[model samples]
Target: RTLTGHESVQPQTSREMLSSGHWLIPTIGGDVWLERPPPPMWWIGIVYTVTGVKASDSIARLAAVLAALPIILLTVGIAKRLFGKGVAVMAGLILATMHEFYSYAINPEADIFLCLIVTAVLALFVSMEFPHVRTTGAVAGSGKPSFFGTRPWPMAGFFLLLGATNWAKGLLFGTVMAAAPIVLYLLGRALQERSFHPLRPYLWCWGWLIAGAAALAWPVAVIGQYPEILQLWQEHYLGRLHRGYLREPWWYYAVQVPYVLLPWTLPALVGLLCSARAAWQHAGRERFICCWALSAPLLLSLADGKHHHYLLHCLGGWAILAAVGLAPLWGWLQDKLRLIPYSAALGAVAMALLAGTGGILWYSRIPGRWGTIVGAVVFISLATWVILTACQQHHLLRAFVGILAPILAAYWLWVPYQASYLDDYKEDLVFLRGAESLIPNDVPVLVQYDWTAPLETFWVLYHMRRPGVLIRDPWQAAEKTANGGQNSSTAYVLARRLDLPLYRRAGTVETVLESTRTRGEKNPDQRRVLYRIHFTQPLPPAPEDYLRVVRRTLW
Candidate 1:
């Protein structure tokens, strides 16, 4: 359950910011981390100060949890406006229970916040531009006045939210993601309506001028202090776009759609087809939702840098579309199965539950998991029964509950089970914790690792609870240990076991700790060893390496 990979960056940066009192600029290992903006770190810092809690994985993730609430509400609002209440509930539940959304909901990262801001922006834009059109009935001017009132105020709110996306990430990534769909929807609407009216407002809106100024405020303020950020921004943006950083084929996101949507994949696919058909036939909410759902993936695929989490911002559209797809399917099931007896339905449900329970007991042979198994089975059965009983007459909602309840229960059970028993990074954690216990607080730790694995070095430093220097070139190990001293001094160096001979050439190396792998494990790349290096004599200086300091911004 320890934070690994990019998850460690949030707390590490937050800790650095709080300790250094540098809220405007985020630093890691006493260096300005220009890779991301400060909003996520600021949110974590606020949570820590208000709750008096130390920075940990759970405390840091609380910020993500808070950010996800608005996304659900906004999705429900959009769905309710577009379809009816039934579809609204389905959309909300689909988004809340999605595997990808759940994964990012608990992760302390900026993607979820970006998704929140983007969803709000899109919802505000839709409410302003499109009247509410229900599937069963059409209402004229059903777009209710927002809290800021009608006309230019709501427009201003939309632009402001779009501008705030910069704070969520950096370099206008969110702005691009939010704007693409809006432009596409407007173009599509203009073509459908056979007029240039929809395009006019977007071009002449005064709110965009204010929003542009507001969006530039953060970058301008930061650049005024550290002008080098301009270069960093250029490199970061251009590198990701054209320089092949984490490059993937255009079909990468297309392939990941099913996995991202999980249980609703089939429904979403159906809904996407339905939306396309509806859009082709007439200009309505389907056209907008289709644009919203498809724009992110299509636009992101153009970038060389592609990640599965990058699509998180567009999940609301997919969720609503899935609801749209489910409504008709639900109606068909109701009509076809109406003649079935309640006793037969209950019997089938019981049999399916029993089969699932048997599989769980059979497969999960881990010790001390019986309690979770029993608890899950009991809770799922009781909850399913209550839901079925309450909505027995309404076949559509009952069917949804039947499909959704078990998945939710299983997810609830899996969290504790995975946290307690499943740890893929246990070897690294064990080695780091062992090194922390063996090494003295005053003794500086020099992590001698190849420049390729920044996450490993970051994991060590974050858990070690001290700033350490990185010696990417093994030849500099002795020079680092000497610390410009001719007298005797000791420092611990962490290196792979395979690279022990290289460090032994630098100084007197004594193995202090070693990471152990499970039996039959064939991967030798991760076998790390901590060595206590003693410097009796000064060593010659080596040429500077590009990665001498521990940089946490690589990810």
Candidate 2:
């Protein structure tokens, strides 16, 4: 799939960095774009350099996948440290198969990278502080705890990642997301233990100085170059805390939790309930995992800004909790089904798998999809036979295999199919390519668009390989292209057909290139036109516009 929406930002900025040879500051359309920190761009740049391949969308997305692999391993390690090995395996599977996590794994966005770093930081903190927590039937830890509850290496790694969170997202957002949970867990521990011992590790860790230094490095360097960026940074970071940006209701995240968790929603809720009960009785790993899981969503809910992707940071904790809830349920199924015959259970499972496969094949009877249908059928049949053969020794094994096999198959088959099918929804890149061929490389292009709809402009800048400037107001474009203006030499404006009248009012507009394409399944008549504007006279100040009002209202 082509990069669309904000996903284009990653490769666009990386290309700029490589072309301009300015790694410290990232640029988009030849303008410094400090809205996002430079780590994801740096990762993409590194991938381009190491592979010696042209920077394509696929290669850029590969960087995100590489970053996500560590998150899965870290989730497994964290679960193993808190629960037993059984729960660890289950937790890793749940996280890896989750729809949101899988979507972001290949997406060229900073959220997945942020999630990786945050998970690492919390995992190290758990290993350090709760190294010897007692589980249901076993104790989980590497060995006896060393000084400060961990050795020097892990302590240094924890502080380093904790500070590196700033680079993942920004100076304030990542640090707050990581630290809030630690503070909550420590407060809970202090209340339960009736001592200040839980706070000792934080006080003694002077490696925080290293973390602080690392976090401040980029901000200080960028601010030194452009002091005005300090104000922009404040508006971008601190402004989200109030009711000005992406404001949703207080219970927004609560409503989204079930959808995000998908198949594990009920199990995660049960696990959360069990952990809450356990924490009420004692201070242990349950409390720590609970804090890790709930802290970010709770804190983000309090703030006005909310988006579904922000919940990625909390997925690790929820996956572990789902495992915690699923382990006993597996045992319960074994005990409850002892009276049922083994042949009867296997027959029932086989019948259900056949029915599901038959229904899918019936529904997806397209001419070209027959290959995929046959493959899915054969895969399901083999998987069912293998499960039945392997679990003949024990009913408990049969029950576990029965529950997990379908999920694995869906992750391998259905997810990819859905992604491929949805790739046809947005045709921005197709139209932008058509428009790109019409405009010369030497001519400057100004993308006239509303502030809210910058995705197409970003697409032009990235795919067209031109220094495109986004102008929210038509007057801005006229001012730039007016006689004796800075950009008066052969400038063109790319805008939608609906917005052509507004641009015409600002100047004498000539249609250079007009293209029409379906935006998505719902909006099939989308049209875009490139216009060469010749400013005849200076336009007076315009009245208040609806787009400007909406932009101000939101920002």
Candidate 3:
């Protein structure tokens, strides 16, 4: 709402490129950087070119949302090819509802696009049936898909998608996608046949050609034009992947998976275990899906850099697995609750019991023993009644509602409240826009805070149309801007409330605007206070402000 649909706000990854107006060759701070490919930027650039419109969050995010469509279709097709139509629909539904997948579906980045490409690769991998069923249709895969001898077209398609994924983001996920299918096919074959077969000659030639061509296509073109970018690529890969940049604990995703998958976590877990069991018994499509799902995470866990979106490509596996359980669970629910009778009386009784449980939990002051008894009785009765009543209908729709009720409730209830703090960027952007009249457009607006939001910076520069810059220190800002130009005496500074004292100690400052915002989940006592202070002069030479000067040494 803050910016028009035509104007897009980019994430930090895209911010540097957007600011530098560099699309063909990626750069950071005006230097050549090829950590990410130019495919996404090129795509966005095409949107701008065709529409004759400027960048906006709407257009940038539209790319991601558009990428999601093919992913969903590919997922359904893959699931249908392997499991059948029912599982396909369930897989689509599971993916559509997943919080993590949908989150990136709206993000203005290449992550979701990469996810789409990787998923397409996996779908193609699943499409090519085993040699025993080479002439079979989608639903007739012979439980033993050989990666080496897959149909020529599907193998070509797999390589194409893998290449697209590499160009869409980086090679991290692309490498994983390319290797995963081959490894899974080999492993699945070994598990089922108890022997390894030699690579078929015709298939091996085509595979090698596709692999070599797809892997080198973009890099050859890029490096041929700009050889310096290759060094940046090597440094980035070595530093970030090997040395560690955004490294988290090895178990980071282990903890995050529960939150990421949300309501589907339990079902996915059940399905994963089932797939494992099925793989153990006889390696088949389930084993392939299981392998695809686990590959990226296992590789990523071994790597130093970790981000949640990196797991987006793997979510399709989780969704398909989760979908595998939905039909069986629904069937069991129908069979179990068919005789229970879904009546209004039963629902009312359940609701009343739940209400009583809530009341007891809230106000039951029965000291110790009586309170425990009351709590247990109320809780148990409520649980039993609700389960019975929910299952009474025995229909798929009712079962779905029962299964997803908590998640739906949380989305409808808790999300608005959580978003109040989580999406503080909107308010901050609006605040900056409102203060536009008070602050001069020409004077640089220094955002001095420890934690910064890239969206806010995008909003400030693009939406607010002001000279927005972020500095680590207010004193350093004062030092640089002081007597630097005509508007030097009136530059604006947005700092947290805690940092305001530091600014005051360093120089003369005037508060133009101030507002309090929730800091985050942690730091309840602290807040993200936006203090729009106007620095009048440079700071005096002093020891306390020496740290600020020292920080500027990098500049």
Q: What is the C-alpha lDDT of each candidate?
A: 0.73, 0.72, 0.61
> What local lDDT score does residue 270 receive in model 3, on the 0 to 100 scale?
77
Question: Which consecutive 10 residues in model 1 have the weakest lDDT in total?
Answer: 136-145
Candidate 3 residue lDDT tens string, 126-176: 655433321221222333445455644665666566556677766655667
Candidate 2 Cα deviation (angstroms), residue 446:
4.5
Better of 1 and 3 by lDDT: 1
The CA lDDT at 435 in model 1 is 82
Cα error of candidate 3 at position 242, Å: 7.6
RMSD of every prediction: 5.3, 5.6, 7.6
Residue 363 in candidate 1 has what lDDT?
55
Q: What's the true lDDT of residue 160 in model 2? A: 81
Prediction 1 global C-alpha lDDT: 0.73
Sort the candidates on TM-score, descending order: 1, 2, 3
How displaced is residue 392 in candidate 3, in Å?
5.0
Total backbone collisions for each predicted model: 0, 0, 5
Per-residue lDDT value at 300 in model 2: 90
Ranking by lDDT: 1, 2, 3
Residue-level lDDT of model 1, residues 1-555, one tens digit each, is 667666777777787788889888876555566777888888888888888965667777787788888899999998887887889999999999999999888877788888888999888877766555464212223334333334566766887888888887886899988898888877876786786666655553456766787688888888887787877888878988999988999899999877898878877888898778777666578887888888988999999999888888888999998988875655655555555667434744785589566758675674456665556566656665554443344666777877787678778777877877776577777778788778776666677644445555555556665566666554555556566354336667877766676555556778888888621235765477788876436543544543344322333
Most TM-score-accurate candidate: 1
